[model samples]
Target: MMEHSVIFPDHRKVCALGQGTWKMGKSALREADEIDALRAGIELGMSVVDTAEMYGNEEMVGAAIRGLRDRVFLVTKVLPGNASRTGTKAACERSLNRLKTDYVDLFLLHWGGPHPIEDTVASMIELQQEGKIKAWGVSNMDVPEMERFYAVPGGVSCAANQILYNLAHRGVEYDLLPWCRERHLPVMAYSPADEGRLSRNPVLMEIAQKHEATPVQIALAWILRCPGMIAIPKAGSVTHVQENYRSLSIRLTAEDVDLLDGAFPPPVRKVHLDSW
Candidate 1:
């Protein structure tokens, strides 16, 4: 198997920086601009580019990684509503066609839905066995659901867990993080800046001033500091991509980390899907 730097424990790589393709398919974004942003991200050392079949941005991502396919660690999710073995398998094939690749570095179940999780997980494993994907994981899953999924045969090998983790929403800190630590499952944080909230927070701004760094950089760096954590903040422009990359350079001191951790602790949110 090809070795990847982004892989965390259990042979998963830290998907260094990635471009989320949600906006690429928007009617407002001109094709040229979308392509430009993707090219910029690749040039800037963001090897992982995340997309989803539901996003309708797979074609754009496929175009972006055309010549650079070998270097990029492509990841995409299958929507939960489409979870049957046949549906899932067909979706993966469609994604492969749209992505212009035979296999993806990681394929994730977008969310836990009504379908039998075990059935979908089994299909995912079959894909891996067939060399259609290198690894598999789940997104937007909580500690209990994650545990349940892991309990399924051939499921404990889940490589990563993508969640909405950021400075403002650190609820995962209480249980998810520790659970992942025990299983060696890397946590892939999406919206690490809380949709630009942390990027402009007053407290974060003050901390950034002390370090002479941008608040967004501080937030992303903080996420990266978490054990077995990786982040995939979206970049809509080249400037934003450059700015996000700068986060990798800012090293938070022990005191700085403590202050930030105490200042903005995890929020209490309705995390249980059972309630939803």
Candidate 2:
């Protein structure tokens, strides 16, 4: 639904609305359905697909986006445990193979694991040189931690930061969001619907009534309304993905925002990051 693009340091345009794939491969019972959901979303213009080695579903994602690889902006992560200079390269190679692609549009450090940020970042740089990943970033970061992340040599090249952010969990607004804003770095908000916990809010329901849309749309609209944001809500069915895609066209008015703000107020003080 987003016509404009968020340019990475390498000058590639990143789509704003995406599909998150967490707990996607943890079960085999629904593999085909999950792949259908992904392919459906991509067909509907939600081309950015975010996954991680930690999610255990790169193979499924690779299958779903098989023929549509170039149309989608693929993102995957290496676990912190695998962040060593050698480990990062190896892990990325494995991910690339599993993804059935030569390279990923964006690659990330899944979290702040035991590895030194320098070693991990250096490895990411190497992978970029070898064209394994076009750009790299970190996930689940706080403002202070991200500051320390960039302080490392070549750390300033981080293209984006993925974190748990949603209407119900607005903790990043207190600091992290503004930090990325100043630097023009896109903040990829995983679990943008609070893992599907936001659709039942009474206020969201009331607003949805006014817009003639579902509460899910109102919840996602709030996140996309913000500047420099990319919201990825996972879908396991084609219907769900289509619903998310339709949210892109739901533009909230100032009054709609004010009412929702009072119901689910923004954080005035810092709160801890909420994760899956």
Task: Give the top-scoring candidate (TM-score).
Answer: 2
Off by over 4 Å in 1: 1-6, 9-15, 267-276
Q: Listing every candidate in turn, what is its Cα RMSD in Å to the true structure after a full C-alpha superposition?
A: 3.2, 1.3
Badly placed stretches (over 4 Å) of model 2 are none
13-71: candidate 2 lDDT, tens digit per residue? 75678899988866788889999999988887787899999888899999999999988
Give each model a TM-score.
0.90, 0.96
TM-score of 2: 0.96
Tens-digit lDDT string for candidate 1 (9-68): 446454455666665667654766777777887777777788899889898888878898
RMSD, model 2, all Cα superposed? 1.3
C-alpha RMSD (angstroms) for model 1:
3.2
